[model samples]
Target: MTDTFKHHLELLIACVIYGTVGIYMQQLEDMSIGSIIFYRIFFGLTALLFYLSITRNLGQLALKRKKKYLLLLGILYVLQMFSYYSAIR
Candidate 1:
């Protein structure tokens, strides 16, 4: 597959994984919703960071990206996560 095609395929797989999270997460007991959210974010961040580093995209991303957009993205991510956590709780 082409690089762009592979990227799209990966995104599709990610959507499937996320689609199951709610069902899978609900099966676990004795765990707080905060813990679930923390684990998801912590592991997801690590995986993305590792993928970027492996692809040598970290440096490229830093050089090519604007700081303002990163800040905005971060804010949006946090808000999305807060909403997800609220719904889960």
Candidate 2:
């Protein structure tokens, strides 16, 4: 496949995966919102690490600078996810 086709395919797959998150969350309505968010982040981080290992890009994760900024970004991301899941719940 050409690069354009491959990119589009990846985009489409990502969209499908993202679109199903709400359905999955709804199905797990019995679980606490914090538990749901934790599982989501855990699985997402696992998947990301797996992908990085497979693509031999693990070295890219090394923090060369701006440690404070990275921490801030992570905090923001957690807050965002918490708000998002809370809203959906």
lDDT of 2 by residue, 1-89 (tens): 99999999999999998768788887898998878878878998999999999999999999999999999998998898788888877
Q: Which residue pairs collide in model 2, if any? A: none
Regions of model 1 farther than 4 Å from truth: 1-12, 63-65
Model 2 alpha-carbon drift over 4 Å, by segment:
51-57
Q: In model 1, how large is the Cα lDDT of residue 70?
A: 87
TM-score of 2: 0.75
lDDT of 1 at 39: 86
TM-score of each: 0.61, 0.75
Give candidate 2's whole-model lDDT.
Answer: 0.89
- How many clashing pairs does model 2 include? 0
Q: What is the lDDT of residue 19 in candidate 1?
A: 76
